[model samples]
Target: MDIQEKARPPAEVYDAQFVPALFAQWGQVVCAEASVREGDRILDVACGTGALTLAAADIAGPSGSVVGLDVNPEMLAVARRKPAQIEWLEGAAEALPFPDNSFDAVVSQFGFMFFEDKPKALAEMMRVLKPKGGLAVAVCDAVENSPGYGAFALLLDRLFGKEAGNAFRAPFSLGEAGQLTAICREAGLSHAEVVRRNGKVRFKSIDALVSTERACAWTLGGVLNDEQFERLLNESLSVLEPFTVDSGAVEFGMASLIIKARKV
Candidate 1:
């Protein structure tokens, strides 16, 4: 299957109310360091649920502009309802709708892994950015680094073997710092740097977290089947039994890498 189809969830669960808030919290932190000047135009590619878009909007203020684009209509819908000031557009990262050198800054949060054509998306991001403009993209580190999700991943592998597991090259391709920097260079970006980030993966409950798996379609794509999926769902809940804390809340140590580059 193509990337888009593979990325589509079983249903449009992103329309849920809490989804936007969930993403916005971390999105703000991810784009926190990006410097924006007055009247600067920014583009948020793969703007899932408008997390980066909303953050960019906050940075751009009124005089400046922030354009959020994503291929998923469901995600765009969730993004549009937030404040209504951010310009929400439906587009693919591989083929941006803006002209060359159109944006002062381009940012993405946890999106580079899902791109079918990494080079194409990076090229598009570069083309839309003005000379010497900034680009920042963040991606989850490898499964080994993200130990917080160890139980969750173990359950998945138990249910589905290595073949259909989450080991698919797509998600793990840029998991390494060196690999991510190399990808930036290959995409025609310069002055690349990778920042290691430690974060938390919080969940209300194991079941709730597993249920939201559908919303994280891009990651679970092609990783599970009907029988295997159900088995994993049930097994994961059992695995999370010991980790239960107060109020059905659980937090795990998460690791990620922030790749910053310059369009020159």
Candidate 2:
């Protein structure tokens, strides 16, 4: 399946299965860095399922405004159901529908790597922000730094060759701190700060993790045949064995970079 097709999973599956497992913690971290105030206006660009958007809304309080914008209508659909107060809009990062200098802060979590025109998108993000507005973005680190993901990539390469591996690696494309900061500078965002942090990724069991991967539209979903899927599950069990704790649950360290900047 193509990248677009892979990204079009049902909203419920994504929210129920993927959010708690991988996105919730990062959402909190990104929102905290945004430094939203009681009356601030915040925009979450590419806010998948409104994870970060919801967190921002709590900080923004009753008088403040928080808008969750996404290119996918399905994601917006799910986001709208969460908080009745926050506005959910269907839009792309490259061309924000809001007026210039409309928001006091902008934040994105694990979404920048997927933008087709990142420079244009960054420019648009800055254009919508008030002067001195903060911008916080979080992206996964390189696959090598993430052992579990590294193993998965190696397995995909062994099974389906380079294309499959590349697809798996797309999320980590902007892994380097220097590269991310440079991109922000090129897009006219000044004094960008990039920090690397470790987050814990956990799964109740190996089967649970494998199930999520198979169901995730952006991962190996629909790519593996029944037999290949079975083989992948069995093979991955061995690979993840080391990360499994005495309680039978699996946990691993995940490294990610948080890039903070201001529209000076």
| lDDT of candidate 2 over 121-214, digit per residue (tens) | 8899888999989888888899889887788789879977887778778888999988987888788766778888788778777777767676
TM-score of 2: 0.91
Q: On residues 1-264, what C-alpha lDDT tens digit does candidate 1 reach at each position?
A: 122422445434443422432444556656654455567799999887776777778777888898998898877876677774888899899999998999998889777888888878988888888987877787877767655466666665666665545553245457788887778778876677788877666667765565556335555644566565566656766677776678876556666688777776
Every model's TM-score: 0.83, 0.91
| Window of ten residues with lowest summed lDDT in model 1 | 1-10
lDDT of every predicted structure (CA atoms): 0.70, 0.81
| Candidate number achieving the greatest lDDT relative to the actual structure | 2
